[model samples]
Target: MMNKPYVIGIAGSSGSGKTFFLKSFLNHFKSDQVTLISQDDYYIPANTKTREENRLYNFDIPTSINRADFYKDIKQLFEGQTVFREEYTFNNPDLKPQMLEIKPAPILIVEGLFIFHYTEVNELLDYRIFLDADESVALDRRLRRDLIERGYDEEDVMYKWTNHVVPSYQEYLLPHKEECDLVIINNTDDPKVIDEAANKISVELHEKNSTLNII
Candidate 1:
């Protein structure tokens, strides 16, 4: 039986279905038992740069994130303290964030492209998950997602994918998968894969609690 909350770090390349898997995983339990902390919420607060400058910003890199704040918030959750959830607008640059209160829970999920890229954040995770997807599939999914959710045009999406997103994944994100305890191959068509992953986590949590009780 562990005394602290169970922290799971889910990391993967863009368009690897990390969001899809997370949503599915969270569906297994009641909302009170779990909380999600997304690294996307910590992106360097709306900068004053121009549209082209913002477009040129390498969001895939570690520097694009305010890691210190992210670490502090997660650490607070670990200490059974409340944190304010930072709301990030996908395509809005000038909008200020709306921070909402987030209560601690038994299971805490930290998901992002660079969840494992920062040493401090990686050390705090009780379990790590890496989602793998084919480059072709990932590219297609990313293109579609950016177009609809992020309001990026085809040319811009392709440019960013080929230039920043893919390169950053190869340089920083992909190698960190070696540190993860579980590697999930995210096939967009398979719901069973998500279901199985959820069950594995549930069983592990139950077993850990049982052991802690015995101890």
Candidate 2:
């Protein structure tokens, strides 16, 4: 049986390079040694909203997530139960969502914009990492991602950035920055810094959990 996992909570503002950092971090270990539970998958479906209304819907707030269910699943994982979740596709018509099977591992990573804000989820985190970036840099990355990947127009992206994302970051995420065990500032285009940070963190985690085999 797997021992109690060392849980890591990762949070950042929108476009703070979390996706990139996570990709780098996961590379250090075999897939079975680590499990990732992303808050994006726990978004409450807004099927009633029209296309135009969907653009106006504020998904940046903590209320937009099914926090109760998210916490329950995490608890189940801690109890050595495997969890299954439907992948959230951002309402993209062309993308087909998959069923994600998450098994308990020595290292569990919970990532989201509001993971730190949700009190129950925050309490489960053994370590916390916050990604930081300049406002202009994050805004630019958000614009490109929403426009190309999510099929959002420039106007809608800017509207959400100004009205929803920025406010939520200030109110929910930024306040918890100092509480994090590690803070990574990712402003430059080069991702080498992120890889280096991930390597260092992974080494320490492996040292703590000696059962985790390095790949």
Candidate 3:
């Protein structure tokens, strides 16, 4: 049997530096040898029924994603096979059916809030990382990103964070931290910590390869 590629999962609260860590790790590996699979891509289309119930559209929790497709894509990555998948654009309800012809890369990194939330994805990872950030810091980052990029105002952003993001983080994201192989606290601007964590993961992967034939 052929050796399966290493699978890594990076989970975190919003704006907790998972993206930075992922980029840092990618820098260490050749592009052909690494592929990034984000849970953000698995978000479900906004249902008017659900949106009306909540009064706000949040793509943060488990139900936000298309469970069937997400599980299937994770399975493909875990098997060292390729899958063409959809990219989830925030609040875009239409599915255009664009296919990205993905080849199986040797290192697969999956990052998101709910990657660890679901059992199928959790089981597929060889190693997992959880990002820990202070609530204030996370909120500040979210506010800035939403206001500048997503066209949300300060009052609405603050209200959304208080009501939706923070509570969801505690209830859904925090409890799953213990499931990860490592938990790193994210620094807002300075990514020294993110780089360190990525380096450590590289070292650990190398060590595992040398000792246990864990390719």
* Candidates 2 and 3 compared by lDDT, better number: 2
- lDDT against the true structure, per candidate, is 0.81, 0.90, 0.74
- Pairs of residues at least 3 apart in sequence or in different chains that clash in candidate 3: none
Q: How well does candidate 1 match the true structure, expressed as C-alpha RMSD? A: 3.0
Q: Provide the clash count, candidate 3.
A: 0
Cα lDDT, model 1, residue 77: 82
Q: Against the correct fold, how does model 2 do in TM-score? A: 0.96
Tens-digit lDDT track of model 3 for 47-78: 44454443466655678778788778767766
> Evaluated with TM-score, which candidate comes out highest?
2
Q: After superposition, how far is residue 133 of candidate 1 from its true place, in Å?
A: 0.6
Each prediction's number of clashing residue pairs: 1, 0, 0
Give me the overall lDDT of model 1. 0.81
Worst 10 residues of 3 by lDDT: 46-55
Model 1 residue 117 distance off true place after TM-score fit, in angstroms: 1.7
lDDT (Cα, tens digit) per residue for candidate 2, span 1-215: 55678899999878789999999999998888899999999999986789899989999999999998999999889898999999998988878899999999888999999898998899999999999899999999998898889888899999999999999999999999999999999998689988998999998987876454433
How close to the true structure is residue 188 of candidate 2, measured as C-alpha lDDT? 82
- Ranking, TM-score, top scorer first: 2, 1, 3
Alpha carbon lDDT at 6, candidate 1: 80
